[model samples]
Target: MNMSTELIGMVAGGVSTAAFLPQALRIWMTKNARDISLLTYCILGLGNVFWIIYGIEKSSLSLVFTNSFILITALVIVYMKYFIIKD
Candidate 1:
């Protein structure tokens, strides 16, 4: 991978995934996933899974690494949304 592309992914993924942290923290703290959109997160989690696969196909470690972390975290949010989030 080119330095530029890696840098871009690092920037985008770092920012986006880091952005996911506050909601995660909130969900963990309050066990409240009410504000989280189940469908949106589900789709997002699936998208991340596909991203990891695509990363593997492309032999892109950064994409795989970032997406893996995001997928787990997002799945956690999804789970919390199911169990903790009130309808």
Candidate 2:
């Protein structure tokens, strides 16, 4: 991997991981995951898990690290949505 490609990968990973923060913050603060689709994120969390595995399989540092971190956060959101709906 050349320096330019590595930089692009790093940038892409950072952007994607950071993209989740705003939605997470909104959900955390408002506890209003009503706007968020439960089924969608349930699927999304599972997708994140798969991506994490794919990243590992491919030995992709950016994908592995970013997806793992995002998956943790995404799962948190999924759980939060479930609990909120339950209550």
Candidate 3:
């Protein structure tokens, strides 16, 4: 990939990863996840795992990093929903 393309990827990845911040923060602060769909997040986290694997195979650092962050954020929400809040 060219420098411009790599930069684009990085920027896109950062934005995508940042998209989850608000929800995660809200759940953490409010300790309320009753409105969150556990199944949806589980599926999303699974998809992120597959994307991370694909990123590894393709040697795409942007994909791997972004998906990993998304996966972690999803897991955090899942944990808080299932364990912390039980909601």
- The candidate that achieves the highest lDDT relative to the unseen native structure: 3
Off by over 4 Å in 1: 84-87
- Using TM-score as the yardstick, the better of models 2 and 3 is 3
- Tens digits of per-residue lDDT, candidate 3, 1-87, equal 577776887899999999998998999899888999988998999999999999899888888899999999999888888889855
lDDT tens readout by residue for model 2, 1-87: 467775787789889889888988888888778777768777877888898798788767777788777888787777777775443
Candidate 3 lDDT trough over 10 residues, lowest sum: 1-10
lDDT of 1 at 55: 96
Residue lDDT tens for model 1, 1-87: 898898898788888789888988988888676677878888988999999999999988779989988999888788778876665
- Taking all chains together, each candidate's TM-score versus the true structure is 0.81, 0.79, 0.91
lDDT of 2 at 12: 91
Using lDDT as the measure, name the better of candidate 1 and candidate 2.
1
Better of 1 and 3 by TM-score: 3
Model 2 lDDT-worst window of ten: 78-87
The C-alpha stretches of model 2 lying farther than 4 A from their native spots are 1-3, 84-87
Assess each prediction's global lDDT (C-alpha) against the native: 0.85, 0.78, 0.90
RMSD of each: 2.1, 2.2, 1.2
